[model samples]
Target: MSGNGWLRPKKSRQKLRKRGLDNPGDLTTISSRSSIKNGPGVSVDKDLPPLPPVAPLQAHRLKYKEAHSRIDTQRGENRDYTALIHALGLEDPFDDDESWPRRERDEEGERPPGEPVVASLPSHLWTQIAGYLNPKDAVCLALASRTLYARLGKAPFEALRRPENASHKLALLLTLDRYLPRHLLCFPCGKYHLRSQPGCEKLQPSDALVRNPVFVCPNARNMLRRAPRHRIAHGWSLPFSLVQLATRAARFGPHYGVDVDALARRWKGKSGDSEDGWSHSTRFLIHDGRLLMRVVSQCFAPPNLSPSGQRLLLFSRDDYFPYFSVCAHWRDGELTQVCKCALTHVPEELPRGPQSIEAKFKNSLLMGPRRPTAATAPTLCGFCQPMRRCPKCPTEYLIEIKLSEVRNHHHRGGVEFRHALVVTRWSDLGDGSAPSTSLEWAACNGDQAGAGYDSFSRLGKRAISGIFEAKISSDNTGIPGRRIMSMNPGNVKGGDDWY
Candidate 1:
């Protein structure tokens, strides 16, 4: 016996079995007889009935076990692709289960058709009713029925087609949202355009112009009527079509648009001429009929940066906005100040020996305090160390200093530990309505409504960052950190160098 005191029991220490007792061989290779040996096989293999060829494999994995299986079916026998989904006896992916009717039926039965009663009403009554209605409503009422369409004629539609009533026409077109699943409302053209790429549409790089079009538009090249887009970061912007796709799918069914997972993305930022660079990560979630967005931006920091150095590190040269995502009210808040404060916490190395004669004599008497190194943990002050929500918009921010392993191409192992400044932002992008109309969408862009966007009133107690983080993480208890507070307590903006 090998005398090792810590040796485990023989059963526990034995190697994995070569052939699994809990498994069964392939269906094609199974023996004609049932178990002659005492050991039983997988529960699935016992008393299993024979199945048709290639049912277990996917469409991409199809192969001919027998030549008869691949008969081209000129005699009309091929079931084609109706046949991985059905073989597994699963419900069709495109099928709508609930399938509500266009108009609600009464409790007694379906609503009685009233064509006779509608026809009995004089034509002048509709004209009288339409006179009190707006262009949008008038057009909708006229088209509601065949009887009404004949009586109202083309007057309401002609009125809506006028240049001044364009908004009314657009509103009228928006009503087709329920009817058209393969088309998107084109705002600039005021029409429903067939989706060029349809369900497979993908978000592309801001610079990759040709790869991003969902539907072709006549006004695409017209500078005055460009596509609506929201800025995500320095060079990244999300076009409105993608939002329409996501919301349409959520509102209707899977076939209507792409999954929300299609929008989640991770990408690196460009490091141009300067050594200081940023990396941005973004993900999306839909909650309460509203789309939420989270962006995390991080960059390595050196110790004891000057005012100019901080500016050079944070802001971009072209537009002056930071490389991270931010709402319209960024400048009015304490966001920049909080970043500068975190930078101050990055401890700078001090000289061991005192230069002055009095300091040298004082140091000789007692040993100096323990010196701080680059790896020392940074401690942030109260003013800058809490979760902050933008008082103006439905957006929140959290700034943190974390010790991260950075990759360096020049280093031997191509890795080194460094302190990085991480800024994370969460914004509610609204209920996927028209960009100009949705308050959340407009507010995030700094488009004013009356006084201004009051995020406290709009979002209430629910912090977007907290809700978003809780959703993706394993734990559902809640965000385990500091209480959320206003980003700018003073509500001050402009004219200050401190920002």
Candidate 2:
């Protein structure tokens, strides 16, 4: 009887019989394996829960992003960069003058001897080749190999040490920064000093610099060995070390240096010789491998000022420099005239005209108060209103006369509205390269060593006042319709026009 019971069970047979499928059929859910179209393939059913709609979290795009992260330069990701560094120098970093992908010694510190071809070259030939190179390049050439170093000897290094070659020597030292993250290059001493404050260095004003020396150096008190800084207004100057810090963090990683926001500062000088009653605020931004600085200086000015009065208001009595921030080449341009031209636009209250007392009384009653003559902000002329870029430096200036509110404790209600002159300077400090090698920094400082920085050629058409303002334009006011023009088309200097 057990052997004869090979058919379906009684309950199953009853269910199949009830559904009229006692025998399996093609494409039936009960025994779909018999389907001729596709074996074990799922069939659509309204009552069945839908197969999870193709998961996007781990799709093909996941691998694509993983591949992209391997080569992204902004985040400083590099694939086989150690191998590539054995190729050409950093300036021509991607160039390859070898037959194979170069790599360094293994973990055991074992490397093959110098190339036979390199050793075979005559010393005179190497000397001749180095003769055409600058001091920095010559040093780099010597450091490339022991064979080259022996051929070049100490001549290149000796030449780099001469006082005249200070700039060149600094350039050579800056290239070694990657190997020494715990040190910062001292431009004056031409050496890398151990960082005193390390990751937590703060940039202070010129007065309180004793608190945070970037490094301890015997030249700290030396007047000539002062850390290089750009004058941002009279009392406030930006130390170049902070520029190095901000840019290094952007290029490499955050732990190497401080974030850009940490460098931002705002302070008011109420009782200083140069910046009395002036307010200065500085902001920094990193764009296109360069550090952009914006120094906004504002000071309240009285309306209807004479030429002498304008000079007294704009120029500080101590140093005779403008209270606003400017580059070293400010004197050789129309920047002074631009500021003066903007000052002339301050709306002046004219003498009151004789009016009908009855009409005046009626208007006075109708209006809550008589409208002031200088109620609206003044508009500057085309010559002065447009942004002016220093032709010789990577600096741009915008002079504006705006109506600003000032709170004075001596006033009746401790609040007053007045016209103020605002000067905004934007500069593109170069890409953390040595100050001597950075064209923008040297050009801004008017150092004769870097005369090759043609502002129009290097920066192109869009660099004027854009690098720094691109960040805060949504919150603060921005220059919308203004065009950038050369500050000094004639390049005239020390002339009556500037005076």
Candidate 3:
């Protein structure tokens, strides 16, 4: 057995040289599959065991080269490239499962102990770090951890809810806290003013939040300890502004705005008394027992109204102006902000469709106090008139409201106001569509109160109108035999005197 370490091609050296072929050239190598025992083969038979899957590096193999040589070179190159890739831990292209090594934990194992337990800290600690991150980064972190996502629910709500930060507040308001357990996460404020209802009391401790030592707000601790309980009917109108309404509409458009950052800011940091020093709140007049306050700015607090009804209908940016009123009996329950609507600058043509419409307060009069009256329905043939000045005499009061847009046909710039009186139930104005007869006002007196009149009329006409209205609606005529009085003639003497 005369043996050679390596086999040479059968072609003579002289012939190969004549053909200008080199060692790497196509004709200089063996062609059979068995010749490539060290590398992948070009299987000649369809039934032959499948050649090992082609290595990615084999894509560059020269087709004209001897099949066995090409396979051997490709196999060596693929092995080297694969080792390099494996060292870097790059993804295996053919793998269906894309999971990669967890870099943090992998690196942790490589290091000695006492370096730092960064990788294994409970997820909550990571969330606390995320909280301090910018919004974009915080969102990334939230997506990475289910635990972080839970803790971050409405996390940014506080940032948007502060008074000066109304633009953001509007954004949060329009959002629904879908993550919360109750589908509701009420951010109760520390202190607020209200119009007094003599017999009402504050909420009980069980009904409100109890003081928690861990709470960030100092006042919350004291409030929790007091477990304050008192009746609540009326006292102060909530602090809401026009600005907040407009921004809300802009931020949310048609989407949800529930954000934790906004709630936290409004609850823990911002208030009516903010650094801006702008008085964004005002005390509105209570006419006929109905509270009225117009929203007119960009930054403001949400109003507080008792929830006495099932569905609270809020109108945001109504007809370009933001206006809201509660539904029937919503006021019978404790005060809480339900759904938030985005605020928007008044549009040119106020929407008149279903979207602009809201539930009107039922059994509520827009204005007028609750008290007994003297004159009863004229008793047929016999009568006893109660003393007009008796405590039972229903006190009559009037309030005038006027409104003009920033620009109007009359050249008035900014909002303009006209006046009207808060008249008691006096008459039925044709249809039940009178503005003063809105259900909000009805809550105070319902059908018992009369329609209100614009602050313009001759004295006799005013007196007659008031008398007729009061007699027909209240079932009482005049103050203890005194004839009804009309509008003051002095009010219409001249343009300057008009109110």
Candidate 4:
């Protein structure tokens, strides 16, 4: 019951243990028969097919090689497999190695041939460069090479379509093609001409016409047919004197006096010669806050005027100042008669009696040179004196005229006489000095006609002592009137009047 209970005798075991107790190490080992029995379907060691005959070392290595080959084939098919491999915490084979070929070093340290030397730019950059060129230069460049031509053929035209390129296009046209067919289109008749000519050439006979050739279609037949009707619908054509007066007023306004020689020189450039026996005079004033300029001339004439048999000729083709009206008056002493030549309709009989003459003169003076029956005549004449007055305000007017004379040789071997007349009107701008609102007339016999008509016309030769007077008067209505008063020689001012 103590050390050895079941396997050895209880009392005798102590005595046997002293004798090694049946070999204690042997007692710890159990017999084969006492081992646990194998379960059903269990196999002996010899029945397990001898462990599949242990594959050869070379065969095992072959299996590993086949797996590596499949992995490499799949790596090319799946582009992202390498990245996936890296994501899975696998070491990348190419991480430390150079993906591209390393350039071989030379003593000069030059770049290798693996990469391109010059980089190619986009097409838009070349177009931007072309855009910076001038139109003419660009056109030339486009024509220089076929490649450039293909690219830039329409570039110049396309650029002109832009609003900012308008000036460029105009400059090109003016410098390169001033007489282009498109510029020769006629404004009034909407016709094109083969070449430019003076408008007068078409209207008058070659012997009676004198004008500078201009860059406009001058269809003489059309002008002659349309001129009279146009005048009737507008007003009498202004003489050279009045035209010069208006031009001066427009150039200098009311502050400066007109200088005839200076103006001629300015217009004619350095070609004008004062010794050519040309003369001019100008007078100016302010009326009802409007500026008025008058110019008179003698001997020299404008390009638009030429000599005819007994009367000075005017082409009456220019329509620059459509709103202006023209009047002509001639008097021999107290006797005055309105010239019927410039009028639309000339009366066969003259009015008799001093009162009737005065009334007719007044009517003609205010009505301008055009006949009263003319279609262009205004319902109320601008120069008419008003009948009523405005109590709160009053209007003031001024009138001035200058006479100039020049003596030149006529083809007949006698001294030729020339005269000019200029008139201007001004309106107050609430300032002390009025600015010019309109230039009435600046006319010269030298410019409009060869000389004074007195020697040529029967009526002019019958005149005794003549005077030309320009008067300004205001009525109670605060409206002012301008009239050619008496023709007495004493009433006419000399050329020095402008000073």
Candidate 5:
């Protein structure tokens, strides 16, 4: 195997020898044998196979053409197709009016050549085309110009006015300035007419304007447009006094005051010379903790009021101070006291009260637990002082409670502690009306709420202590009995008194 390398390259000679061994014959004989073996097969030398007979030009051309064909079937160019259509037109196609187009044609030998039939679009088609345009463009195209706007049909405008369609409102506001009557644009009505009417002396300075009507500016006209249409049967403009009060109050507070007369003059000029005036009320501010200036009790129409027409409003001391308390009017002057527990701590004891209520100091109001959800429920968590006034009781009180669960092995489940508070009412109640109530309690699971129900299930189980007392009711006094005493089991009750 090594010596063969001297003659031809060793691997090339080996491959050639392997091929010779496989052939073992002449190449020409191999083809002759293949032809004999395959029945009726043509030989390579046999007349080169008749060169494929020539095809007709038309057939070959059509076969070689691309698959797609574009046809331009517009007017004219094809007389035969047009003649066929004309023949069909001789009889009525749509209805029994065989003579309609044909009759007209018949009256005039034959219809003129090259005249196209104009088709009319259906109403729905026009609406669809108009809807795509913006409100302004739609109005311009469909309403502003009679020729174009009329054809659009009223549906588009109706669609625009819908409350959900802000664009419609904007469009109406924009267009109203151009067309609204003078009386409709002014606040008090009289000034607008005098200024806008022709031949009015107030408008005499612009004499040419009287001769020709000038359209109001778009910005001015737009201010008049509003919807959910209803007419104001009656309206009263604010008096100069009230307007001055509001403007001055806004500009000046306990900390600063503004020029009232100068402000009034500025306002007067804006209303114009008229008996019926216009006033704008902007802001009202509270100074320190009280209304700096009084407004008419009817400043805001009271939806509900006491028999005496007194309206009640409530506010929290926390709004002005960190600890629990509220500002109240006693006898005459305003006073502030520690009315309840500060909300910062949870599982808290209630506030303590005084024995003989001092002139300036009142008894401590109940500050129930800070946690709202508690391990147990108490039927009287919301009970108040049965008596209107007592040395040991605060007239008004608030209770806020939140519940949280604490871990314990004895109980299968944890207990939820309640946060509760009782504070004095912020507003005054005439005699027997029930006060509005609110609570700030929340229920939390042991894993998240912190403690469990068993924490205070048994007497003396709760380590947190707070003093509580109920008003000696008339029934208890008649029976010569002592007042009932209890504590908030869970801090569930939360929120203060309402007038």
Candidate 6:
């Protein structure tokens, strides 16, 4: 009917009549329909009617509601009723069905409901819990139960190895190991000495110094005689010096000396000795990779003494000068006197508050230079007179200490001697030159004698009022080949006798 043979108003009737089809008016003719029905294609059921039209709005809404209800019912069949009820904040409506879930009771292995869950946990779980605890608490827990002990195994120690637990670990190790002597060498005898207890069966002579390792040896009696110049055996005194060093180090750090109190408390229970006029306390610490110690001792005055007797005992004398001295023996066989401070009565005006005695002691001793002047200068007596050499030579690097009593006033008074000790590396002292007239030389020689006896006495009393201290530094150039012995007035063996 149209130019492309599609239906058009003008030619549609003519075209249909020519084709002789009853359905010509329709775009789909009878021949096309017949071909489609019989064509080689997928089969369809002509007998079934087309699906009904989409339901109306009300019917559609009703169908959706029914489907949703069915789904909810199915879900409820498998739901956790306890969780659901709790989430809904509802009480149980059915007595037969409890809302709280309970584990099926196992009569053979069941624990009491009130017991801690920790006790029933596996070993691995307990170890995990212990990993969170501090080493000390973990150790205590381990000791409480055999099962926990077995489970903990080395976990506590491993935990201590961690950086966070370093302080606790150090305290434990020090507490356990402190019984071992600090130094094994006997200064006088030059032999290893183990500490001996009251009933210790170690073979030794009756004259051996008992109850202490540094003093324990067959030749202990010869200590005073061997180094007669020094009042106590240099060997026996080394342990005390180490104690002084440790005490000083502990005052600054947390770990090193904390165990001292614990150890002291333990010792108190074991030693039932009565309180006496003389008291001694010692502590040790490790600082900057070196051992430190501190010792505090109280020396009470004799019961009674006349003025002359006091002068003889307390005044400057050749046989004994009351003071404390520290000497360092280098590896190169150089024994240098680092510090020599007089021991005098504590001043009445000085404050003794809650401050640590160790800190005060360290402060008192560290008042001097790091390097000893005697190391480079010519050795002289306290009077500035030339001195002699030591009788015995040191085989190894070591430290020597001396303690004695000195007068604090011209007139007779109650006498007391308190000493504090400290050790430090030589490098800590700066490169400052020694003064032309150092306190060591001035105090020894009384060069200030022009100031008069009263002034000198006051000066001497002030000098000896505080603690004695010493410092050691690395001498990379090594000690000089020429060895010079200390010329202390306390030296009774040889040297100028002026005091």
Which candidate wins on TM-score?
A: 1
lDDT by residue (tens digit), candidate 4, 1-499: 5555677522211111121344445322222222224334333244323322223443465577675654546445434566667765665444433554454433245445321311143346546767788765666556555566555558766776566655455444433322332223232333334333311112111222324222333554465523111110122222222222223334445222223222221111011232322223333343333333333322222222223411221111233211111222211121111111112121222333334556656755776432323332222222222111111111111222122233334332222222221212221111111011111211111113212322213222211111112222233232223332223334342222211
Q: Which should have the higher TM-score, number 3 or number 6?
A: 6
Q: Cα deviation of 40 in candidate 6 (Å)? A: 99
The most accurate candidate by lDDT is 2
Candidate 5 — what's its lDDT?
0.28
Which of 1 and 2 is the better model by TM-score?
A: 1
lDDT digits (tens) for residues 157-238 of candidate 6: 6776777765565445434333433323333343335533322222121233244432356764555634111111111232
The C-alpha lDDT values of all candidates are 0.74, 0.75, 0.27, 0.30, 0.28, 0.33
Candidate that beats the other on lDDT, 1 or 3, i.e. the better one: 1
Badly placed stretches (over 4 Å) of model 2 are 1-168, 270-275, 349-375, 409-415, 474-478
| TM-score ranking, high to low | 1, 2, 6, 4, 5, 3
Task: Rate residue 202 of model 2 by lDDT.
Answer: 63
Q: What's the true lDDT of residue 139 in model 1? A: 86
lDDT of 2 by residue, 348-384 (tens): 6455465676766676677634333454768889899
**Superposition TM-score, candidate 2 onto the true structure:** 0.66
Q: How far is candidate 1 from the true structure (C-alpha RMSD, Å)?
A: 27.0
Q: What 10-residue stretch in candidate 2 is worst by lDDT?
A: 11-20
lDDT of 4 at 311: 26
Candidate 6 backbone overlaps, count: 19
Question: Candidate 5, residues 1-499: lDDT per residue as tens digits?
Answer: 9777788622211111111334456233223224335335332334334222222443354464432122234643444555567767777564455656776765686655321211155556666777787665665556644444445777666766665665344544434433432322222111122123221211111223224322232333243531111100012111212222223234333112222222211121021234112111211222222111111110111222332332111121223221222212121111111111212222433443433434213312333322443443222322332211111111222332233233336533223233332222211111110010100000011111222222223212211111111111333332222232222222323223222
User: Candidate 1: worst 10 consecutive residues by lDDT?
Assistant: 9-18
| Model 4 TM | 0.21
Clash count per candidate: 0, 0, 92, 51, 62, 19
- lDDT by residue (51-165, candidate 3, tens digit) is 3333223323533343434235745543445666685676645443337556665567843653245455665676678768655455555555455556565554444344665
Q: Higher-lDDT candidate among 3 and 4?
A: 4
